[model samples]
Target: MDEYPFTKLVIERNLTREEFAILMERLEKLNEQYEAQKEEGLIHFSSLLIHFAGMLTEKLEPDSTINALQREGFYPSLMNEFIRIIKQNNKG
Candidate 1:
Protein backbone atom coordinates (compact mmCIF):
# COMPACT_ATOMS: atom_id res chain seq x y z
CA MET A 1 0.00 0.00 0.00
CA ASP A 2 3.07 2.28 -0.06
CA GLU A 3 2.10 3.22 3.44
CA TYR A 4 4.18 5.41 5.70
CA PRO A 5 4.98 3.99 9.14
CA PHE A 6 2.20 5.93 10.83
CA THR A 7 -0.38 4.90 8.25
CA LYS A 8 0.89 1.35 8.36
CA LEU A 9 0.41 1.21 12.14
CA VAL A 10 -3.05 2.74 11.84
CA ILE A 11 -4.17 0.32 9.13
CA GLU A 12 -2.47 -2.78 10.41
CA ARG A 13 -3.35 -2.46 14.11
CA ASN A 14 -7.04 -1.97 13.31
CA LEU A 15 -7.82 -0.34 16.63
CA THR A 16 -11.47 -0.26 17.69
CA ARG A 17 -13.22 3.09 18.11
CA GLU A 18 -12.98 2.96 21.88
CA GLU A 19 -9.36 1.88 21.69
CA PHE A 20 -8.56 4.68 19.30
CA ALA A 21 -10.27 7.15 21.61
CA ILE A 22 -8.18 5.93 24.51
CA LEU A 23 -5.05 6.31 22.45
CA MET A 24 -6.08 9.85 21.54
CA GLU A 25 -6.70 10.71 25.16
CA ARG A 26 -3.31 9.39 26.17
CA LEU A 27 -1.56 11.30 23.44
CA GLU A 28 -3.43 14.46 24.33
CA LYS A 29 -2.33 14.17 27.94
CA LEU A 30 1.28 13.70 26.90
CA ASN A 31 1.08 16.65 24.55
CA GLU A 32 -0.33 18.83 27.28
CA GLN A 33 2.42 17.75 29.66
CA TYR A 34 5.06 18.59 27.09
CA GLU A 35 3.55 22.01 26.53
CA ALA A 36 3.26 22.74 30.23
CA GLN A 37 6.81 21.63 30.92
CA LYS A 38 8.20 23.56 27.94
CA GLU A 39 9.90 20.37 26.87
CA GLU A 40 11.92 20.29 23.67
CA GLY A 41 9.79 17.38 22.51
CA LEU A 42 6.68 19.54 22.64
CA ILE A 43 6.96 20.11 18.92
CA HIS A 44 7.03 16.40 18.21
CA PHE A 45 4.16 15.69 20.54
CA SER A 46 2.09 18.46 18.97
CA SER A 47 2.80 17.07 15.52
CA LEU A 48 1.78 13.58 16.57
CA LEU A 49 -1.36 14.93 18.19
CA ILE A 50 -2.23 16.73 14.96
CA HIS A 51 -1.60 13.63 12.88
CA PHE A 52 -3.80 11.49 15.12
CA ALA A 53 -6.48 14.14 15.09
CA GLY A 54 -6.59 13.92 11.31
CA MET A 55 -6.93 10.16 11.48
CA LEU A 56 -9.66 10.56 14.10
CA THR A 57 -11.61 12.81 11.75
CA GLU A 58 -11.67 10.12 9.06
CA LYS A 59 -12.80 7.52 11.58
CA LEU A 60 -15.70 9.52 12.98
CA GLU A 61 -18.88 11.35 11.95
CA PRO A 62 -18.99 15.15 12.18
CA ASP A 63 -20.79 15.34 15.50
CA SER A 64 -18.93 12.39 16.94
CA THR A 65 -15.68 13.79 15.67
CA ILE A 66 -16.36 17.11 17.36
CA ASN A 67 -17.21 15.41 20.61
CA ALA A 68 -14.15 13.19 20.45
CA LEU A 69 -11.85 16.13 19.82
CA GLN A 70 -13.43 18.16 22.58
CA ARG A 71 -12.96 15.26 24.95
CA GLU A 72 -9.32 15.20 23.98
CA GLY A 73 -9.12 18.93 24.79
CA PHE A 74 -8.68 20.25 21.27
CA TYR A 75 -10.43 23.36 19.96
CA PRO A 76 -12.95 22.33 17.30
CA SER A 77 -12.88 25.25 14.87
CA LEU A 78 -10.06 23.97 12.68
CA MET A 79 -11.46 20.45 12.79
CA ASN A 80 -14.82 21.76 11.65
CA GLU A 81 -13.15 23.40 8.68
CA PHE A 82 -11.28 20.22 7.93
CA ILE A 83 -14.52 18.26 8.02
CA ARG A 84 -16.16 20.67 5.62
CA ILE A 85 -13.29 20.33 3.19
CA ILE A 86 -13.31 16.56 3.45
CA LYS A 87 -17.04 16.43 2.80
CA GLN A 88 -16.79 18.80 -0.14
CA ASN A 89 -14.01 16.79 -1.69
CA ASN A 90 -15.90 13.55 -1.19
CA LYS A 91 -18.88 15.03 -3.01
CA GLY A 92 -16.88 15.70 -6.15
Candidate 2:
Protein backbone atom coordinates (compact mmCIF):
# COMPACT_ATOMS: atom_id res chain seq x y z
CA MET A 1 0.00 0.00 0.00
CA ASP A 2 1.14 3.51 -0.76
CA GLU A 3 1.55 5.88 2.17
CA TYR A 4 -1.51 8.09 1.70
CA PRO A 5 -3.86 5.31 0.69
CA PHE A 6 -2.70 3.08 3.51
CA THR A 7 -3.08 5.81 6.04
CA LYS A 8 -6.55 6.84 4.90
CA LEU A 9 -7.81 3.28 4.95
CA VAL A 10 -6.25 2.49 8.29
CA ILE A 11 -7.97 5.51 9.74
CA GLU A 12 -11.30 4.88 8.09
CA ARG A 13 -11.34 1.35 9.40
CA ASN A 14 -11.43 2.53 12.95
CA LEU A 15 -14.44 4.77 12.57
CA THR A 16 -17.53 3.72 14.47
CA ARG A 17 -21.05 4.54 13.42
CA GLU A 18 -21.38 6.75 16.45
CA GLU A 19 -18.13 8.54 15.76
CA PHE A 20 -19.12 9.27 12.20
CA ALA A 21 -22.50 10.29 13.44
CA ILE A 22 -20.84 12.56 15.93
CA LEU A 23 -18.70 14.08 13.26
CA MET A 24 -21.69 14.67 11.02
CA GLU A 25 -23.47 15.99 14.04
CA ARG A 26 -20.77 18.48 14.65
CA LEU A 27 -19.16 19.60 11.39
CA GLU A 28 -19.74 23.23 12.28
CA LYS A 29 -18.16 22.48 15.59
CA LEU A 30 -15.38 20.82 13.70
CA ASN A 31 -14.96 23.96 11.67
CA GLU A 32 -15.12 25.99 14.86
CA GLN A 33 -12.47 23.78 16.35
CA TYR A 34 -10.42 24.64 13.33
CA GLU A 35 -10.88 28.30 14.00
CA ALA A 36 -10.19 28.09 17.74
CA GLN A 37 -6.95 26.29 17.20
CA LYS A 38 -5.97 29.10 14.93
CA GLU A 39 -7.17 31.81 17.29
CA GLU A 40 -5.40 30.09 20.16
CA GLY A 41 -2.21 30.68 18.25
CA LEU A 42 -1.73 27.22 16.93
CA ILE A 43 -0.10 28.02 13.59
CA HIS A 44 -2.01 27.75 10.33
CA PHE A 45 -0.53 24.38 9.54
CA SER A 46 -1.40 23.13 12.98
CA SER A 47 -4.90 24.52 12.63
CA LEU A 48 -5.37 22.69 9.36
CA LEU A 49 -4.06 19.61 11.04
CA ILE A 50 -7.29 19.36 12.97
CA HIS A 51 -8.90 17.66 9.98
CA PHE A 52 -6.13 15.15 9.86
CA ALA A 53 -6.59 14.78 13.57
CA GLY A 54 -10.28 14.22 12.96
CA MET A 55 -9.56 11.53 10.42
CA LEU A 56 -7.07 9.91 12.73
CA THR A 57 -9.67 10.27 15.43
CA GLU A 58 -12.38 8.54 13.40
CA LYS A 59 -10.02 5.72 12.68
CA LEU A 60 -8.70 5.35 16.21
CA GLU A 61 -10.31 5.12 19.63
CA PRO A 62 -13.52 7.14 19.67
CA ASP A 63 -13.67 8.29 23.28
CA SER A 64 -9.94 8.70 23.38
CA THR A 65 -10.16 10.71 20.17
CA ILE A 66 -12.69 13.08 21.72
CA ASN A 67 -10.60 13.27 24.87
CA ALA A 68 -7.64 14.18 22.77
CA LEU A 69 -9.68 16.92 21.06
CA GLN A 70 -10.66 18.22 24.49
CA ARG A 71 -7.05 18.10 25.49
CA GLU A 72 -6.10 20.03 22.39
CA GLY A 73 -9.02 22.40 23.06
CA PHE A 74 -11.63 21.50 20.45
CA TYR A 75 -14.72 20.87 22.55
CA PRO A 76 -16.32 24.27 22.19
CA SER A 77 -15.87 24.26 18.46
CA LEU A 78 -17.60 20.91 18.32
CA MET A 79 -20.53 22.05 20.45
CA ASN A 80 -22.65 23.68 17.76
CA GLU A 81 -22.24 20.87 15.33
CA PHE A 82 -23.03 18.36 18.03
CA ILE A 83 -26.28 20.05 18.79
CA ARG A 84 -27.17 20.35 15.13
CA ILE A 85 -26.35 16.79 14.30
CA ILE A 86 -28.07 15.43 17.37
CA LYS A 87 -31.23 17.30 16.59
CA GLN A 88 -31.12 16.26 12.98
CA ASN A 89 -30.62 12.62 13.90
CA ASN A 90 -33.53 12.68 16.24
CA LYS A 91 -36.03 13.51 13.53
CA GLY A 92 -35.31 10.04 12.11
Candidate 3:
Protein backbone atom coordinates (compact mmCIF):
# COMPACT_ATOMS: atom_id res chain seq x y z
CA MET A 1 0.00 0.00 0.00
CA ASP A 2 0.94 3.69 -0.08
CA GLU A 3 3.00 5.28 2.67
CA TYR A 4 0.47 7.64 4.23
CA PRO A 5 0.73 7.89 8.00
CA PHE A 6 -2.94 7.17 8.68
CA THR A 7 -2.91 4.17 6.36
CA LYS A 8 0.21 2.79 7.94
CA LEU A 9 -1.12 3.37 11.43
CA VAL A 10 -4.38 1.58 10.72
CA ILE A 11 -2.59 -1.31 9.02
CA GLU A 12 -0.29 -1.64 12.01
CA ARG A 13 -3.35 -1.90 14.21
CA ASN A 14 -4.58 -4.95 12.23
CA LEU A 15 -6.98 -3.50 9.67
CA THR A 16 -6.48 -5.12 6.28
CA ARG A 17 -5.82 -2.99 3.21
CA GLU A 18 -9.31 -3.70 1.89
CA GLU A 19 -10.90 -2.58 5.14
CA PHE A 20 -8.79 0.55 5.21
CA ALA A 21 -9.79 1.35 1.66
CA ILE A 22 -13.45 0.93 2.50
CA LEU A 23 -13.09 3.18 5.52
CA MET A 24 -11.26 5.76 3.43
CA GLU A 25 -14.05 5.76 0.88
CA ARG A 26 -16.62 6.34 3.59
CA LEU A 27 -14.47 9.09 5.11
CA GLU A 28 -14.23 10.77 1.74
CA LYS A 29 -18.00 10.91 1.48
CA LEU A 30 -18.19 12.32 4.97
CA ASN A 31 -15.58 14.92 4.07
CA GLU A 32 -17.60 16.03 1.10
CA GLN A 33 -20.69 16.42 3.24
CA TYR A 34 -18.74 18.31 5.87
CA GLU A 35 -17.29 20.62 3.26
CA ALA A 36 -20.70 21.43 1.88
CA GLN A 37 -22.11 22.18 5.32
CA LYS A 38 -19.18 22.88 7.53
CA GLU A 39 -20.82 23.84 10.81
CA GLU A 40 -23.59 21.30 10.59
CA GLY A 41 -21.31 18.42 9.60
CA LEU A 42 -18.24 18.78 11.83
CA ILE A 43 -19.64 16.40 14.42
CA HIS A 44 -20.36 13.79 11.75
CA PHE A 45 -16.83 13.98 10.41
CA SER A 46 -15.26 13.82 13.86
CA SER A 47 -17.53 11.03 15.02
CA LEU A 48 -16.80 9.00 11.89
CA LEU A 49 -13.06 9.34 12.44
CA ILE A 50 -13.40 8.21 16.04
CA HIS A 51 -15.59 5.27 15.00
CA PHE A 52 -13.11 4.27 12.30
CA ALA A 53 -10.32 4.33 14.86
CA GLY A 54 -12.31 2.07 17.17
CA MET A 55 -13.01 -0.35 14.34
CA LEU A 56 -9.36 -0.38 13.29
CA THR A 57 -8.34 -1.33 16.81
CA GLU A 58 -10.93 -4.05 17.25
CA LYS A 59 -8.44 -6.88 16.76
CA LEU A 60 -6.52 -5.81 19.85
CA GLU A 61 -7.69 -6.76 23.32
CA PRO A 62 -10.77 -4.91 24.51
CA ASP A 63 -9.96 -1.24 25.13
CA SER A 64 -6.25 -1.97 25.13
CA THR A 65 -5.42 -0.01 22.01
CA ILE A 66 -7.88 2.72 22.89
CA ASN A 67 -6.38 3.10 26.33
CA ALA A 68 -2.95 3.35 24.80
CA LEU A 69 -4.23 6.04 22.48
CA GLN A 70 -5.52 7.95 25.47
CA ARG A 71 -2.28 7.51 27.36
CA GLU A 72 -0.31 8.65 24.35
CA GLY A 73 -2.64 11.65 23.99
CA PHE A 74 -4.11 11.17 20.55
CA TYR A 75 -7.74 10.11 20.06
CA PRO A 76 -8.87 11.27 23.46
CA SER A 77 -7.51 14.72 22.77
CA LEU A 78 -9.44 15.03 19.55
CA MET A 79 -12.53 13.60 21.20
CA ASN A 80 -12.39 16.28 23.84
CA GLU A 81 -12.14 19.01 21.25
CA PHE A 82 -14.95 17.50 19.22
CA ILE A 83 -17.15 17.34 22.28
CA ARG A 84 -16.39 20.93 23.18
CA ILE A 85 -17.15 22.10 19.67
CA ILE A 86 -20.40 20.18 19.65
CA LYS A 87 -21.42 21.58 22.98
CA GLN A 88 -20.57 25.14 22.02
CA ASN A 89 -22.51 24.84 18.78
CA ASN A 90 -25.47 23.42 20.60
CA LYS A 91 -25.50 26.34 22.97
CA GLY A 92 -25.51 28.95 20.24
Candidate 4:
Protein backbone atom coordinates (compact mmCIF):
# COMPACT_ATOMS: atom_id res chain seq x y z
CA MET A 1 0.00 0.00 0.00
CA ASP A 2 1.14 3.56 -0.57
CA GLU A 3 2.43 5.43 2.43
CA TYR A 4 0.15 7.82 4.24
CA PRO A 5 0.61 11.44 3.11
CA PHE A 6 1.81 12.56 6.53
CA THR A 7 4.24 9.64 6.62
CA LYS A 8 5.79 10.89 3.38
CA LEU A 9 6.16 14.35 4.87
CA VAL A 10 7.74 12.89 8.02
CA ILE A 11 10.23 10.89 5.99
CA GLU A 12 11.07 13.88 3.80
CA ARG A 13 11.69 16.06 6.84
CA ASN A 14 13.73 13.30 8.55
CA LEU A 15 11.68 13.71 11.65
CA THR A 16 12.44 11.41 14.57
CA ARG A 17 9.63 9.10 15.62
CA GLU A 18 9.21 11.17 18.76
CA GLU A 19 8.98 14.32 16.71
CA PHE A 20 6.38 12.73 14.46
CA ALA A 21 4.39 11.71 17.51
CA ILE A 22 4.47 15.30 18.72
CA LEU A 23 3.34 16.46 15.30
CA MET A 24 0.46 14.00 15.42
CA GLU A 25 -0.50 15.38 18.80
CA ARG A 26 -0.58 18.87 17.35
CA LEU A 27 -2.65 17.63 14.45
CA GLU A 28 -5.18 16.14 16.87
CA LYS A 29 -5.53 19.49 18.63
CA LEU A 30 -5.96 21.22 15.29
CA ASN A 31 -8.63 18.66 14.36
CA GLU A 32 -10.49 19.44 17.57
CA GLN A 33 -10.45 23.12 16.67
CA TYR A 34 -11.62 22.32 13.17
CA GLU A 35 -14.54 20.29 14.51
CA ALA A 36 -15.51 23.06 16.92
CA GLN A 37 -15.49 25.69 14.19
CA LYS A 38 -17.06 23.53 11.46
CA GLU A 39 -20.56 24.84 11.99
CA GLU A 40 -19.22 28.37 11.54
CA GLY A 41 -17.46 27.16 8.36
CA LEU A 42 -13.79 27.49 7.35
CA ILE A 43 -12.50 28.92 4.11
CA HIS A 44 -8.88 28.13 4.91
CA PHE A 45 -9.65 24.47 5.52
CA SER A 46 -11.23 24.08 2.07
CA SER A 47 -8.42 26.08 0.52
CA LEU A 48 -5.81 23.96 2.22
CA LEU A 49 -7.47 20.74 1.03
CA ILE A 50 -7.67 22.04 -2.54
CA HIS A 51 -4.08 23.29 -2.41
CA PHE A 52 -2.86 19.91 -1.16
CA ALA A 53 -4.68 18.09 -3.95
CA GLY A 54 -3.15 20.42 -6.50
CA MET A 55 0.30 20.00 -4.98
CA LEU A 56 -0.02 16.22 -5.14
CA THR A 57 -1.08 16.40 -8.78
CA GLU A 58 1.99 18.51 -9.55
CA LYS A 59 4.37 16.29 -7.55
CA LEU A 60 3.33 12.79 -8.56
CA GLU A 61 2.24 10.81 -11.57
CA PRO A 62 -1.54 10.74 -11.88
CA ASP A 63 -1.90 7.01 -11.22
CA SER A 64 0.54 7.03 -8.31
CA THR A 65 -1.25 9.91 -6.62
CA ILE A 66 -4.62 8.27 -7.13
CA ASN A 67 -3.36 5.05 -5.57
CA ALA A 68 -2.11 6.97 -2.57
CA LEU A 69 -5.42 8.80 -2.20
CA GLN A 70 -7.39 5.59 -2.48
CA ARG A 71 -5.30 4.07 0.28
CA GLU A 72 -6.18 7.09 2.39
CA GLY A 73 -9.84 6.07 1.82
CA PHE A 74 -11.72 9.19 2.92
CA TYR A 75 -12.36 10.69 -0.51
CA PRO A 76 -13.10 7.36 -2.15
CA SER A 77 -15.41 6.29 0.64
CA LEU A 78 -17.17 9.64 0.61
CA MET A 79 -17.83 9.37 -3.11
CA ASN A 80 -19.03 5.80 -2.72
CA GLU A 81 -21.48 6.86 -0.04
CA PHE A 82 -22.71 9.74 -2.16
CA ILE A 83 -23.30 7.44 -5.10
CA ARG A 84 -25.08 4.92 -2.93
CA ILE A 85 -27.36 7.61 -1.55
CA ILE A 86 -28.16 8.91 -5.03
CA LYS A 87 -28.98 5.43 -6.28
CA GLN A 88 -31.21 4.71 -3.31
CA ASN A 89 -33.04 8.01 -3.71
CA ASN A 90 -33.59 7.37 -7.40
CA LYS A 91 -35.12 3.96 -6.64
CA GLY A 92 -38.03 5.59 -4.80
Candidate 5:
Protein backbone atom coordinates (compact mmCIF):
# COMPACT_ATOMS: atom_id res chain seq x y z
CA MET A 1 0.00 0.00 0.00
CA ASP A 2 1.21 3.50 -0.77
CA GLU A 3 -0.04 4.26 2.71
CA TYR A 4 2.94 2.35 4.15
CA PRO A 5 6.57 3.16 3.32
CA PHE A 6 8.07 -0.24 4.14
CA THR A 7 7.85 -1.39 0.58
CA LYS A 8 9.51 1.81 -0.65
CA LEU A 9 12.36 1.48 1.84
CA VAL A 10 12.98 -2.20 1.06
CA ILE A 11 13.08 -1.59 -2.65
CA GLU A 12 15.66 1.11 -2.06
CA ARG A 13 17.87 -1.36 -0.20
CA ASN A 14 20.60 -3.49 -1.88
CA LEU A 15 18.44 -6.58 -2.00
CA THR A 16 18.68 -9.02 -4.94
CA ARG A 17 15.79 -9.24 -7.39
CA GLU A 18 14.46 -12.42 -5.79
CA GLU A 19 14.59 -10.86 -2.34
CA PHE A 20 12.82 -7.72 -3.55
CA ALA A 21 10.14 -9.76 -5.26
CA ILE A 22 9.56 -11.85 -2.14
CA LEU A 23 9.41 -8.76 0.04
CA MET A 24 6.86 -7.09 -2.19
CA GLU A 25 4.77 -10.23 -2.30
CA ARG A 26 4.85 -10.46 1.51
CA LEU A 27 3.84 -6.85 1.99
CA GLU A 28 1.05 -7.29 -0.51
CA LYS A 29 -0.26 -10.37 1.26
CA LEU A 30 0.07 -9.29 4.90
CA ASN A 31 -3.62 -8.65 5.38
CA GLU A 32 -4.31 -12.26 4.52
CA GLN A 33 -2.01 -13.56 7.26
CA TYR A 34 -4.09 -12.49 10.24
CA GLU A 35 -5.57 -15.92 10.89
CA ALA A 36 -2.50 -18.06 11.63
CA GLN A 37 0.36 -15.92 12.90
CA LYS A 38 0.54 -17.47 16.35
CA GLU A 39 1.09 -21.07 15.20
CA GLU A 40 4.33 -21.39 13.19
CA GLY A 41 6.02 -21.23 9.77
CA LEU A 42 4.34 -19.41 6.88
CA ILE A 43 0.91 -18.93 8.36
CA HIS A 44 2.18 -17.74 11.73
CA PHE A 45 4.66 -15.44 10.04
CA SER A 46 2.02 -13.83 7.89
CA SER A 47 -0.31 -13.60 10.84
CA LEU A 48 2.45 -11.83 12.76
CA LEU A 49 2.95 -9.18 10.12
CA ILE A 50 -0.78 -8.60 9.97
CA HIS A 51 -0.81 -8.36 13.74
CA PHE A 52 1.87 -5.69 13.63
CA ALA A 53 -0.38 -3.75 11.29
CA GLY A 54 -3.01 -3.85 14.00
CA MET A 55 -0.99 -1.26 15.90
CA LEU A 56 -1.34 1.14 13.00
CA THR A 57 -5.06 0.35 12.85
CA GLU A 58 -5.27 0.77 16.67
CA LYS A 59 -7.15 -2.37 17.79
CA LEU A 60 -6.90 -6.19 17.96
CA GLU A 61 -10.50 -7.38 18.25
CA PRO A 62 -10.10 -9.96 21.00
CA ASP A 63 -12.02 -12.64 19.14
CA SER A 64 -9.28 -13.07 16.54
CA THR A 65 -6.41 -12.73 18.97
CA ILE A 66 -7.92 -15.27 21.36
CA ASN A 67 -8.69 -17.66 18.55
CA ALA A 68 -5.09 -17.55 17.37
CA LEU A 69 -3.93 -18.10 20.92
CA GLN A 70 -6.24 -21.08 21.36
CA ARG A 71 -5.09 -23.05 18.28
CA GLU A 72 -3.44 -26.20 19.67
CA GLY A 73 -0.82 -26.89 17.02
CA PHE A 74 1.78 -26.37 19.72
CA TYR A 75 1.18 -26.80 23.43
CA PRO A 76 2.64 -26.07 26.79
CA SER A 77 -0.71 -26.70 28.42
CA LEU A 78 -0.86 -30.27 27.21
CA MET A 79 2.60 -31.01 28.56
CA ASN A 80 1.63 -29.40 31.84
CA GLU A 81 -1.36 -31.69 32.15
CA PHE A 82 0.85 -34.73 31.44
CA ILE A 83 3.29 -33.62 34.09
CA ARG A 84 0.49 -33.21 36.59
CA ILE A 85 -0.69 -36.73 35.91
CA ILE A 86 2.83 -38.11 36.33
CA LYS A 87 3.19 -36.32 39.66
CA GLN A 88 -0.11 -37.73 40.86
CA ASN A 89 0.98 -41.21 39.87
CA ASN A 90 4.26 -40.78 41.73
CA LYS A 91 2.40 -39.64 44.80
CA GLY A 92 0.03 -42.59 44.60
Candidate 6:
Protein backbone atom coordinates (compact mmCIF):
# COMPACT_ATOMS: atom_id res chain seq x y z
CA MET A 1 0.00 0.00 0.00
CA ASP A 2 1.64 3.17 -1.19
CA GLU A 3 1.37 6.12 1.18
CA TYR A 4 2.84 9.55 1.51
CA PRO A 5 5.34 9.96 4.31
CA PHE A 6 3.16 12.37 6.21
CA THR A 7 0.09 10.20 5.85
CA LYS A 8 1.98 7.17 7.10
CA LEU A 9 3.20 9.10 10.07
CA VAL A 10 -0.26 10.28 10.97
CA ILE A 11 -1.63 6.78 10.80
CA GLU A 12 1.26 5.39 12.83
CA ARG A 13 0.57 7.92 15.54
CA ASN A 14 -2.94 6.46 15.81
CA LEU A 15 -4.34 9.82 16.76
CA THR A 16 -7.71 9.92 18.42
CA ARG A 17 -10.63 11.46 16.61
CA GLU A 18 -10.14 14.69 18.51
CA GLU A 19 -6.43 14.68 17.74
CA PHE A 20 -7.14 14.09 14.06
CA ALA A 21 -9.67 16.90 14.10
CA ILE A 22 -7.19 19.26 15.66
CA LEU A 23 -4.53 18.32 13.15
CA MET A 24 -6.96 18.88 10.30
CA GLU A 25 -7.83 22.29 11.71
CA ARG A 26 -4.18 23.19 11.85
CA LEU A 27 -3.67 21.96 8.28
CA GLU A 28 -6.62 24.03 7.15
CA LYS A 29 -5.12 27.11 8.72
CA LEU A 30 -1.80 26.38 7.08
CA ASN A 31 -3.53 26.00 3.72
CA GLU A 32 -5.31 29.30 4.19
CA GLN A 33 -2.01 30.91 5.02
CA TYR A 34 -0.48 29.35 1.93
CA GLU A 35 -3.28 30.76 -0.19
CA ALA A 36 -2.51 34.17 1.23
CA GLN A 37 1.17 33.93 0.31
CA LYS A 38 1.91 31.25 -2.19
CA GLU A 39 5.69 31.06 -1.91
CA GLU A 40 6.33 31.53 1.80
CA GLY A 41 3.15 29.77 2.81
CA LEU A 42 3.99 26.68 0.81
CA ILE A 43 7.37 26.57 2.42
CA HIS A 44 5.83 26.84 5.86
CA PHE A 45 3.20 24.23 5.12
CA SER A 46 5.75 21.80 3.70
CA SER A 47 7.97 22.35 6.67
CA LEU A 48 5.14 21.65 9.07
CA LEU A 49 4.23 18.44 7.30
CA ILE A 50 7.82 17.26 7.27
CA HIS A 51 8.23 18.04 10.94
CA PHE A 52 5.05 16.20 11.81
CA ALA A 53 6.09 13.21 9.75
CA GLY A 54 9.47 13.12 11.39
CA MET A 55 7.93 13.24 14.81
CA LEU A 56 5.66 10.35 14.02
CA THR A 57 8.35 8.30 12.39
CA GLU A 58 10.45 8.60 15.50
CA LYS A 59 7.60 7.09 17.46
CA LEU A 60 6.98 3.98 15.32
CA GLU A 61 8.37 1.61 12.74
CA PRO A 62 7.90 2.28 9.02
CA ASP A 63 6.06 -0.94 8.23
CA SER A 64 3.62 -0.36 11.04
CA THR A 65 2.95 3.14 9.89
CA ILE A 66 2.20 1.96 6.39
CA ASN A 67 -0.23 -0.63 7.67
CA ALA A 68 -2.07 1.83 9.84
CA LEU A 69 -2.34 4.48 7.15
CA GLN A 70 -3.75 1.94 4.75
CA ARG A 71 -6.56 1.26 7.19
CA GLU A 72 -7.58 4.91 7.13
CA GLY A 73 -10.25 5.53 4.53
CA PHE A 74 -9.62 9.22 3.97
CA TYR A 75 -5.83 9.24 4.11
CA PRO A 76 -5.20 7.85 0.64
CA SER A 77 -7.40 10.43 -1.02
CA LEU A 78 -5.94 13.29 0.94
CA MET A 79 -2.36 12.16 0.38
CA ASN A 80 -2.97 11.62 -3.31
CA GLU A 81 -4.44 15.07 -3.65
CA PHE A 82 -1.48 16.57 -1.85
CA ILE A 83 0.94 14.73 -4.14
CA ARG A 84 -0.97 15.89 -7.19
CA ILE A 85 -0.93 19.49 -6.06
CA ILE A 86 2.75 19.37 -5.22
CA LYS A 87 3.55 17.91 -8.61
CA GLN A 88 1.38 20.45 -10.40
CA ASN A 89 2.98 23.36 -8.59
CA ASN A 90 6.48 22.02 -9.12
CA LYS A 91 5.93 21.66 -12.85
CA GLY A 92 5.39 25.39 -13.18
Q: Candidate 4, residues 28-58: lDDT per residue as tens digits?
A: 4544554555557742353333333353323
lDDT of 5: 0.38
Q: Name the better of 2 and 5 by TM-score.
A: 2
In model 5, the clashing pairs are 37-44
| Candidate 2 lDDT, 38-59, residue by residue in tens | 6787643433334545554425
* Predicted candidate 1 versus true structure: per-residue lDDT over 1-91, tens digit per residue: 3324333444555767676777668656644554564455332233433554554534443445444444444544443444555566579
* Native-to-model Cα distance after best TM-score fit, residue 82 in candidate 2, in Å: 22
Lowest lDDT block of 10, candidate 2: 1-10
User: What C-alpha lDDT, on a 0 to 100 scale, does residue 14 get in candidate 1?
Assistant: 73
Candidate 4 colliding pairs: none
Spell out the clash pairs found in candidate 1: none
Q: Which consecutive 10 residues in model 5 have the weakest lDDT in total?
A: 56-65
Please provide, for model 3 over 14-57, each residue's C-alpha lDDT reduced to its tens digit, 9 standing for 90 to 100: 77767657755754564455456555644445554455456543
Model 6 per-residue lDDT tens digits across residues 1-92: 24455465666677666666765675456445545655553333455345435544244543344344435543454344345445666799
Candidate 5's TM-score reads 0.27
Q: State the lDDT at 1 in candidate 1.
A: 38
lDDT of each: 0.49, 0.50, 0.50, 0.46, 0.38, 0.50
The TM-score that candidate 4 achieves is 0.41
Query: Would you estimate the TM-scores of all the predictions?
Result: 0.36, 0.28, 0.41, 0.41, 0.27, 0.38
lDDT of 4: 0.46
User: Which candidate number would show the highest TM-score if scored against the true structure?
Assistant: 3
